[model samples]
Structure formats: C-alpha cells, structure tokens
Target: MEERVWTGWNPRLTTVFSVAKTSTSLQALEAELNSSIACEIEYASVYFFMPETCKKNIPVLVKTASTPYLVVYKSGIPVLNTPILCDTLTDNGDWIVIQRRTSGDVDFFKEWVH
Candidate 1:
C-alpha cells in the first residue's frame, strides 16, 4: 500500500495525492485526476451545487499570467488562448506562476472542485 498526502483543500473539498506517484508520470497522474473528478461528480453532491447540464455551457479558462489560484466569480479570462497560471505564493511572499491543464465539464469540475 502507498501513502496519500493531502495537498490542498477547497472550502468543501479535499485533494489527496500520493507523493510517490505524482513525480513519475505527470500525464498518468492527470488521467487519475480526471477519473477522480468524474467520480466525485457521480457520487458526491455535498459540494457540487450546479445543475447537471450546466458544465457544457461554461467556458474552460486557462491561466494567462502568474496569478494566485484564487477563484473569482467575476474575473474575465484573457482573450488569447493561453495556459492558465497556477499561482502559489513564494516563501518571501511573491506570487509564482504554475501551469495546469483545464479538464472536466465546467459544471462537473466546478461542482467537484469547489
């Protein structure tokens, strides 16, 4: 058996990942992440408050600059097709840019992650 680590948390969500597994093949891990997202959409509704068909209508936003990973309901996405910046604060309190892939149906991912 392997150990799982809690990386981050949303108000009503918990993100658990295996430390040993994440560094090996990021693509495979991402596949696992997609599956986990799908599962959460299927079994849990405590966090997902949106309607089932809503995800299809929402646009997937990718990071355009190095910004904090804060979810803002009113922020506008960049007009260009750019990767989303996954921002994390530095030890000295600076924001660093992290790139991430946008996946899942907007409705499903939003409910599952938020």
Candidate 2:
C-alpha cells in the first residue's frame, strides 16, 4: 500500500456563457449553444429566462439588442425555462444578479408565493 495524501473537497467546476445581444428566439439560442465548442464541452444543463409581456398569452422575449439574457449550464443539458423581469449581470464571474431595481414600480417585498 502506498501513502496517500488527503486533499480537501474539490468541487467540479462549470462555466456559464452569457449572450447579450445576438439570439432572436429560443431555437436560435439553442442552435448557438450547440455550435459553440466551449458550451458543448462545458454544458450539463441550462435554464432560460425571458422578460414578461403584458398580453395575456404573448411570447416571451428571448433576446434583445439592449437587454441581456442569461443561459445557465450544469453537467451537460438544458433543464428549465422560467420568466424574469430584468437582465442578469454576472459580477466578475462570481455572482449572478437575479434582479435589479431602478424604480419603485415593482414591489420587492412580497410573500414567497407572490
């Protein structure tokens, strides 16, 4: 038997690629991700969030020239589709912005089910 050195927990690292202003639709976005070598190698799962529309049953905005959209990946597959109000800003690739506020129009203080 050989002596073994114990190293602390080494979590598997993953990369998230964010597209700011390119994709026009979900299909387009998926195509782009499929074409990207980096995404293909790193992808495990993805979550897509789109801006909400006022119309009762309108389609969500997948990408915009001025707005930002996020694509989260894990192990190697796409897992979820949700809706968000604003764009996400990843600070120094360490933190993900879930929401940003510039006005009091939308209330942040609400119940969990709200």
Candidate 3:
C-alpha cells in the first residue's frame, strides 16, 4: 500500500463536516464528537457517521506533525494508502489507514486498508 502524511491535527470528523451526513444537526455532530472523546469505543478512535455528515459537517484544522509521517488517518483511524486521497487523515505518527478508491468507501481501514 502507498502512504500519505498529514502535518498535524487532521481532524477526520472536521474534514467531512461540510456535507452534513449525520441524523443529527451540526450542533449534534459537535456534541457527539465532544462527548465521544471521553467515551471512546473499545478500539475505535472515532465514532462512525454517514458520509453526508462527514463531508458537510466536520471541521478540519491545520496543525503540525511531531515527526515525519508515512501514513494518514481514516476517520480517526490510521491508514497506509495513497497520499493523494482526500478521505485519509494523519495524526502524530502512531497509526495509518488506506482510503478505498473504487467504492469510495471510508470504512475499509479495519477490513482492507492495511
């Protein structure tokens, strides 16, 4: 698999916040994200949401990487795919995920993006 590097806080939730894919409103997304931070799921870094919510509601911020990178985040999950893919995100330097190109699916980090 290929790799992409994000400098800093590549908020995956924020990146897709523009399209509003959640059953709840923007305020809800905000609340969900904020509340989830303390109540994170077993092995998940981010909660899952619909595509519309991700593209229309989340807000991505520009930050810096603490170290060099060879991967990016896949909606709070890490990826090891191509750098040109927009759906992929990157945090400090711990994990990586790969974006699915054909299906345009973002949920493959756990199943196939390895």
Candidate 4:
C-alpha cells in the first residue's frame, strides 16, 4: 500500500480539500469519505468526478489556509505504507485542489504550479 497527497479547493462549496491514500484500498475509502464529510463539514461536498475532470461544469477558485487537515479513512489494517506526497502539497498544510487525476485507474493529486 502507498499514498499520495493532493491539494485543492472548491470555491462554489467553499471547502478546502485534499486527498491521501490510506492503508485501505479506494473501494471502502470513498464510502468512508462521503459519509464523514457529509457529517463533518456543514455544507461541503466531496465531488470527485474521475480526479482530472472534477465537476468541470462548476468552477472553483484555489485558496490556501493554515490549519485543520480533515483526514478520513476506512476500517482496515493499515499496512504502514509510505504515501507518495506530492511536491506541491506539504504534510498537514493548507492548499487548493486544482484538479484530480487518475493514472491507470489509480487516483492521485496535482497542485497548481504558480
């Protein structure tokens, strides 16, 4: 198991979002994430439409904050996998998600290069 970090934001929803791989596979991860975000964020939606083409119909503005990383995980034995942290985003740091990308059916993140 491995992990990667993605940084981005949804302006319409006004939620700062990022994604990282947990010990468990994406099968249960999506369910867990949707369930949690629905409960935690007041009006936030985790609209993941095939990473690269996330809600293209809607628009978003990228913004960065300085606190609170909302990490959600599924129930499974974490294999202590070392996640591939994107160079664009930092551990527990604030960032905006420009777009989501999937490579060979594996979801990953990419940060906007300034």
RMSD of 2: 22.8
> After superposition, which runs of candidate 3 have C-alpha atoms over 4 Å from their true positions?
1-24, 41-114
Top-TM-score candidate index: 1
Candidate 2 residue runs with Cα over 4 Å from true position: 1-62, 71-88, 93-106, 109-114
lDDT by residue for model 4 (1-114), tens: 122222232342333222323323575888899988877663333232112122222232331345222222211227633222121245433333333465567534556762
Name the 10 consecutive residues with the lowest summed lDDT in model 3.
47-56
Q: What would the per-residue lDDT of candidate 3 be over residues 2-85, giving only the tens digit for each residue?
A: 234343434665666745555447778788898877576522532232121223224434323553322223443346332322
| Whole-model lDDT values for every prediction | 0.41, 0.41, 0.40, 0.36
Which ranges of candidate 4 are over 4 A from the true structure?
1-24, 42-114
- How well does candidate 2 score on lDDT at residue 95? 30
Off by over 4 Å in 1: 1-24, 45-114
Please write out the lDDT profile of model 2 over residues 1-114, one tens digit for every residue: 132322222221111122323334677878777789667553322233432322222344344556444333321223534433333443323233365678989987899888
Model 1 agreement with the true structure over 1-114: per-residue lDDT tens digits = 122233333322422345445556787888899999998875454224322111222333432355434222222355633323323344432232444449753443455547
Ranking by TM-score: 1, 2, 4, 3
